[model samples]
Target: MRLAIFLLIFCIFEYALTVDQTNFKTCDQSSFCRRCRKVKPDNPKFALVPGTLNIYSDSITADLIHKDNKHLFSLKLEALEQSNTFRLLVDEKTPLKPRYKVQDALKSAPKPGSIKVHEGDTEFTITSGPNKAVVTADPFRVDFYQNDILTVSVNAKGLMTFEHLRPKPQQPADGENAENPAANDVKEADEIDDPGAWEENFKSHHDSKPYGPEAIALDFSFPEAEVLFGIPEHADSFALKSTSGTDPYRLYNVDVFEYIIDSKMALYGSVPVIYGHGGGTIVPKKERIRRAATLMKNDPYTLVVCLNSAGKAEGTIYLDDEKSYNYRKGEYNYINMKFENNVLDVNFIGKPNFKTAAWIERVVIAGLGRIPKSATLIIDGASQELEILPHGEGVAVRKPGISVQQIYNIRLNF
Candidate 1:
């Protein structure tokens, strides 16, 4: 009778809860993301005057202009040791202190191959070779090629900008300060050249931009491809949409409540990943893995992103001619998220949740018997079931109605 009663109770609780709108966040909650998104065209932040590109032994660097502004700036075009990807990064490596890197939430990064640049096309180049292809430093743009065919391109619209890093000047201190009484007044501002460059206000929020403005923007185009995806944390479609009539894809991460789907708003976690599928029809018997889904969507995939700091990013993908099946995410043209733009501007941590790490950290408490180690507990499935994870060794029983409908995270603390 006791067992039956217990069984009756546990069934009432299950896991499989559908994600809703309130479970994520927005731009206002994130400090740095908000700061970067507020960047305007004439803010002197886009004042990037072209500087000379200096070629290093295996790398390159340049002195970028702050565009008649007040921020210190530099640009780096470096080569990686094993990574096949070329890096274009602009950031304040050394600031008033240290900035943050939010790269961990991302799954992985792609390695670019040794590339070749040829100038026979528009602000782009064609890259092709054995087991690899690329377009390095094309004039005004960069392009990727696959098996002697051009695939993806960046800066096609020439819409690229990098926000520089600058320190907030100290406030005037003490009563017996300076000879110029006008200079003794404290000034905090946001808009460059505006006296309010040291600080900024948005709604009820005020940001102390100690390491002022460091946002980066770039334009990417996929001429023969469509159905671009990634830049998650939104309640939108897996296939991204055009930002022409709306706000540009928001990248800020926040703690949002139950979220609505098909919207380009910011949410809890973000994956700065993208996948481009070719749009044209393939000849019969020809392999169409990379460009297959794009053809189905009847549109090409174009993507845009912003990066800053020790991290780097490359935007081009080419598939080999081989017919091997490397279909990712259970389908052709699907991509596993590979994040390289590590820009976690916040240093905040979440409360202790063992379920988040339970798969890897298999440590259990001692001094407890039947519930101690290596035992199987049957959990009833709601609509479906998943036993991907198994407890090491413990024998325990709980209220009878155990179900997967509401069991993604269970906390059994001692």
Candidate 2:
């Protein structure tokens, strides 16, 4: 009993010291984040320059100016081929030095799509397929719409804070401003100054930053979203919570010691991709595969098959253009495959059900340089046949019947 009490007390003590929050910096400690958080909503400080838009087939570039300091920035918005994905980029028009751009970030370059521009006096809209982005001129903001529904807005809260590269200020000599104290005070009031912008000290480490602040910050709002997710590699809830009364979530990666489970502290890596979902429908099983085939008919689908002696099944299929970079537009054709005993229930409406219920046992997609009209289906080494049906730039193959708990192989010849 004495030994059991000692072990129980030790476990409680260790749980209490799981994480030390003081080792990390909060929003108040980060100068750039602190200044950005102070920006009030509805008070934007940037505007689009008139007559500076250069519209291309797949992208649109424009000049944006800061309303306060009149800083010139170049903006580019590109549309991906999947029709619903867009990439927006902003940078200094002419910088003192080249800024760092992430490289090798994607598996392949995204396939660009042709965009149609609709210009207006105060706002302009760029559209690809059913997706549209309306860009406002004054107090520059981009409202992204999927299927005509407003889903995401950039710089809507006007919390954008970009600190351009600047030379360090020379310290004034003692008594230099004593003669003109009133004038110096007026000049200081008008200057945008933050003591931590040049250097920061955490614990005993004093970082001597030679270059002035180059931190960039922007706010995104999801007006009609039911929940926000992404910004992965965080040990927090899958659905993000409001940072209203707490420090805003930080994205810098660090090797934290015994990181807190429910906190937003960065772990090993960071991928700054945040997306919001509004509303969706739950399709029934009878119509699920049919709907998936219809939705992904235009794109090439990936077929993954996993087999094991154990009675379980799992796989995935991501639909995309085989030779184009269009998959970056987000989750339009992402499908998760999971089943028990490798039983794939394929329901073909208006067709008779038979005892030989043919299902996808294994699929191998190779040398698909072109779309084929039919595919060869093989089941249990006893049956080998070709199911042929010409789809709209796609192929639909159906096998009449095959018993369950048997291995199946499908080969596509393109």
**lDDT agreement with native, every candidate:** 0.41, 0.64
lDDT of 1 by residue, 149-176 (tens): 3555655554455545556656667764
* Cα misplacement distance, residue 39 of candidate 2 (Å): 1.1
Model number with the top TM-score = 2
Angstrom error at residue 147, model 2: 1.5
Off by over 4 Å in 1: 1-59, 70-74, 78-85, 92-98, 103-152, 156-158, 170-206, 252-257, 266-269, 280-414
So what's the TM-score on candidate 2? 0.65
Candidate 2 has which clashing residue pairs, if any? 111-325, 356-401, 356-402
The CA lDDT at 376 in model 1 is 29
Worst 10 residues of 2 by lDDT: 279-288
Provide the RMSD of all predictions against the true structure, rounded to 1 decimal: 20.7, 13.3
